[model samples]
Target: MDLTGTQRAGATPTWYEDALAWACRPVHHTTDISPLRAHAQAVGHTDGYRPHPPHRTRRHP
Candidate 1:
Protein backbone atom coordinates (compact mmCIF):
# COMPACT_ATOMS: atom_id res chain seq x y z
CA MET A 1 0.00 0.00 0.00
CA ASP A 2 1.16 3.53 -0.72
CA LEU A 3 1.16 5.45 2.53
CA THR A 4 0.24 9.11 2.07
CA GLY A 5 3.57 9.94 3.55
CA THR A 6 5.36 8.10 0.79
CA GLN A 7 3.72 10.40 -1.75
CA ARG A 8 5.63 13.15 0.00
CA ALA A 9 9.43 12.85 -0.23
CA GLY A 10 9.70 11.35 3.26
CA ALA A 11 9.35 7.76 4.35
CA THR A 12 6.98 8.87 7.13
CA PRO A 13 4.62 11.73 7.63
CA THR A 14 6.21 14.48 9.69
CA TRP A 15 2.98 15.61 11.32
CA TYR A 16 -0.15 13.83 12.47
CA GLU A 17 -2.43 16.50 11.01
CA ASP A 18 -2.98 14.52 7.84
CA ALA A 19 -2.82 11.29 9.75
CA LEU A 20 -5.55 12.32 12.15
CA ALA A 21 -7.66 13.15 9.15
CA TRP A 22 -7.10 9.70 7.76
CA ALA A 23 -7.83 8.11 11.11
CA CYS A 24 -11.06 10.03 11.33
CA ARG A 25 -12.14 8.72 7.96
CA PRO A 26 -12.69 5.05 7.12
CA VAL A 27 -11.09 5.41 3.72
CA HIS A 28 -8.23 3.41 2.19
CA HIS A 29 -8.53 0.33 4.38
CA THR A 30 -4.88 0.66 5.35
CA THR A 31 -3.03 2.60 8.05
CA ASP A 32 -5.69 1.92 10.62
CA ILE A 33 -4.07 0.98 13.88
CA SER A 34 -5.05 -2.56 14.72
CA PRO A 35 -7.34 -3.27 17.67
CA LEU A 36 -4.30 -4.35 19.66
CA ARG A 37 -2.37 -1.18 18.86
CA ALA A 38 -5.46 0.89 19.44
CA HIS A 39 -5.63 -0.54 22.93
CA ALA A 40 -2.00 0.40 23.50
CA GLN A 41 -2.59 3.87 22.08
CA ALA A 42 -5.60 4.39 24.33
CA VAL A 43 -3.38 4.15 27.36
CA GLY A 44 -2.71 7.65 28.67
CA HIS A 45 0.90 6.87 29.44
CA THR A 46 3.48 5.81 26.91
CA ASP A 47 4.87 3.06 29.08
CA GLY A 48 4.41 -0.34 27.45
CA TYR A 49 2.61 1.34 24.56
CA ARG A 50 3.48 -0.35 21.28
CA PRO A 51 3.34 2.90 19.31
CA HIS A 52 5.60 4.68 21.78
CA PRO A 53 9.08 4.03 23.00
CA PRO A 54 9.42 2.59 26.45
CA HIS A 55 9.23 5.29 29.12
CA ARG A 56 12.66 4.25 30.46
CA THR A 57 15.56 2.40 29.03
CA ARG A 58 18.70 0.84 30.49
CA ARG A 59 22.11 1.68 29.07
CA HIS A 60 23.30 -0.93 26.65
CA PRO A 61 26.94 -1.69 27.16
Candidate 2:
Protein backbone atom coordinates (compact mmCIF):
# COMPACT_ATOMS: atom_id res chain seq x y z
CA MET A 1 0.00 0.00 0.00
CA ASP A 2 1.14 3.49 -0.83
CA LEU A 3 1.89 5.71 2.15
CA THR A 4 2.99 8.89 0.46
CA GLY A 5 -0.23 10.41 -0.75
CA THR A 6 -1.47 13.77 0.55
CA GLN A 7 -4.82 13.88 2.35
CA ARG A 8 -7.69 14.06 -0.11
CA ALA A 9 -11.23 15.26 0.41
CA GLY A 10 -13.06 13.02 2.90
CA ALA A 11 -9.93 10.94 3.44
CA THR A 12 -7.66 10.38 6.44
CA PRO A 13 -4.11 11.68 6.61
CA THR A 14 -1.36 9.47 5.21
CA TRP A 15 0.55 9.29 8.44
CA TYR A 16 -2.37 7.68 10.23
CA GLU A 17 -1.80 4.38 8.38
CA ASP A 18 1.94 4.48 9.03
CA ALA A 19 1.25 5.07 12.68
CA LEU A 20 -1.18 2.14 12.73
CA ALA A 21 1.43 -0.10 11.13
CA TRP A 22 3.97 0.94 13.74
CA ALA A 23 1.52 0.28 16.51
CA CYS A 24 0.60 -3.16 15.19
CA ARG A 25 4.15 -4.28 14.63
CA PRO A 26 4.89 -4.62 18.31
CA VAL A 27 1.84 -6.78 18.98
CA HIS A 28 3.22 -9.47 16.68
CA HIS A 29 6.17 -9.98 19.02
CA THR A 30 4.58 -9.32 22.41
CA THR A 31 1.23 -10.41 23.84
CA ASP A 32 0.83 -8.49 27.06
CA ILE A 33 0.43 -4.96 25.71
CA SER A 34 -2.26 -2.55 26.81
CA PRO A 35 -4.49 -0.77 24.33
CA LEU A 36 -3.49 2.60 25.76
CA ARG A 37 0.16 1.82 25.22
CA ALA A 38 -0.46 0.80 21.62
CA HIS A 39 -2.41 3.98 21.04
CA ALA A 40 0.45 6.03 22.45
CA GLN A 41 2.88 4.32 20.12
CA ALA A 42 0.67 5.08 17.14
CA VAL A 43 0.43 8.73 18.09
CA GLY A 44 4.15 8.95 18.58
CA HIS A 45 4.80 7.73 15.03
CA THR A 46 2.96 10.67 13.54
CA ASP A 47 5.85 13.07 13.05
CA GLY A 48 5.15 16.29 14.98
CA TYR A 49 1.54 15.08 15.25
CA ARG A 50 -0.80 16.29 12.52
CA PRO A 51 -4.01 17.96 13.60
CA HIS A 52 -6.88 15.50 13.22
CA PRO A 53 -10.60 15.83 13.65
CA PRO A 54 -11.78 15.33 17.22
CA HIS A 55 -13.14 11.87 17.98
CA ARG A 56 -16.87 12.05 18.22
CA THR A 57 -18.52 10.78 21.36
CA ARG A 58 -22.04 9.45 21.22
CA ARG A 59 -24.40 11.46 23.39
CA HIS A 60 -26.72 9.44 25.57
CA PRO A 61 -30.27 10.64 25.76
Candidate 3:
Protein backbone atom coordinates (compact mmCIF):
# COMPACT_ATOMS: atom_id res chain seq x y z
CA MET A 1 0.00 0.00 0.00
CA ASP A 2 2.81 2.39 -0.93
CA LEU A 3 1.22 5.68 -1.98
CA THR A 4 4.41 7.77 -2.24
CA GLY A 5 3.82 8.70 -5.90
CA THR A 6 0.11 9.28 -5.35
CA GLN A 7 0.83 11.48 -2.37
CA ARG A 8 3.61 13.46 -4.06
CA ALA A 9 2.28 13.75 -7.65
CA GLY A 10 -1.48 13.29 -7.08
CA ALA A 11 -1.37 10.04 -9.05
CA THR A 12 -3.28 6.98 -7.88
CA PRO A 13 -3.17 3.34 -8.96
CA THR A 14 -6.15 1.93 -10.87
CA TRP A 15 -6.91 -0.67 -8.17
CA TYR A 16 -6.66 1.92 -5.40
CA GLU A 17 -8.93 4.33 -7.28
CA ASP A 18 -11.41 1.56 -8.02
CA ALA A 19 -11.42 0.43 -4.39
CA LEU A 20 -12.04 3.99 -3.19
CA ALA A 21 -14.88 4.39 -5.68
CA TRP A 22 -16.43 1.10 -4.63
CA ALA A 23 -16.08 1.96 -0.95
CA CYS A 24 -17.80 5.33 -1.45
CA ARG A 25 -20.71 3.76 -3.37
CA PRO A 26 -24.13 3.98 -1.76
CA VAL A 27 -25.66 0.84 -0.19
CA HIS A 28 -29.34 0.00 0.27
CA HIS A 29 -30.65 -1.51 3.45
CA THR A 30 -33.34 -4.19 3.73
CA THR A 31 -36.29 -3.58 6.05
CA ASP A 32 -37.08 -7.26 6.50
CA ILE A 33 -36.52 -8.80 9.95
CA SER A 34 -37.30 -12.42 9.03
CA PRO A 35 -34.04 -12.92 7.13
CA LEU A 36 -32.08 -11.23 9.91
CA ARG A 37 -33.67 -13.50 12.55
CA ALA A 38 -33.01 -16.55 10.39
CA HIS A 39 -29.35 -15.59 9.99
CA ALA A 40 -29.04 -15.01 13.75
CA GLN A 41 -30.62 -18.41 14.46
CA ALA A 42 -28.24 -20.09 12.01
CA VAL A 43 -25.34 -18.53 13.94
CA GLY A 44 -26.69 -20.14 17.17
CA HIS A 45 -28.06 -16.99 18.88
CA THR A 46 -31.40 -18.56 19.84
CA ASP A 47 -31.24 -17.30 23.44
CA GLY A 48 -32.86 -14.01 22.38
CA TYR A 49 -31.25 -10.79 23.60
CA ARG A 50 -29.59 -10.12 26.95
CA PRO A 51 -28.62 -6.82 28.61
CA HIS A 52 -25.28 -6.11 30.22
CA PRO A 53 -24.85 -6.00 34.02
CA PRO A 54 -25.45 -2.71 35.81
CA HIS A 55 -22.47 -0.77 37.16
CA ARG A 56 -22.08 -0.06 40.89
CA THR A 57 -21.96 3.52 42.19
CA ARG A 58 -19.40 4.79 44.75
CA ARG A 59 -20.68 6.24 48.04
CA HIS A 60 -19.17 9.38 49.68
CA PRO A 61 -18.78 9.69 53.45
Most accurate candidate by TM-score: 3
Which sections of candidate 3 miss by over 4 Å?
A: 1-13, 29-61
Q: List the residue pairs that clash in candidate 2.
A: none
lDDT, residue 10, model 2: 42
Model 2, range 1-61, lDDT digits (tens) per residue?
6433454454655756666655444343555442223333464453433233233347778
Count of clashing residue pairs in every prediction:
0, 0, 0
Residue 31 lDDT, candidate 3, scale 0-100: 35
Show the lowest summed lDDT stretch of 10 residues, model 1.
Answer: 48-57
Please say which candidate is ahead in TM-score: 1 or 2. 2
Superposed Cα deviation of residue 13, candidate 2 (Å): 4.6
Using lDDT as the measure, which candidate wins? Answer: 2
Instruction: List the candidates ranked by lDDT, beginning with the highest.
Output: 2, 3, 1
The residue-by-residue lDDT of candidate 3 on 1-61, one tens digit each, is 5668657477544765455445444334523222122223456554333332333356678
TM per candidate: 0.22, 0.24, 0.26
Task: Indicate the residue-level lDDT of 23 in model 3.
Answer: 42
1-61 per-residue lDDT for model 1 (tens digits): 5557556667355455455444444333545433223233554753331342223335767
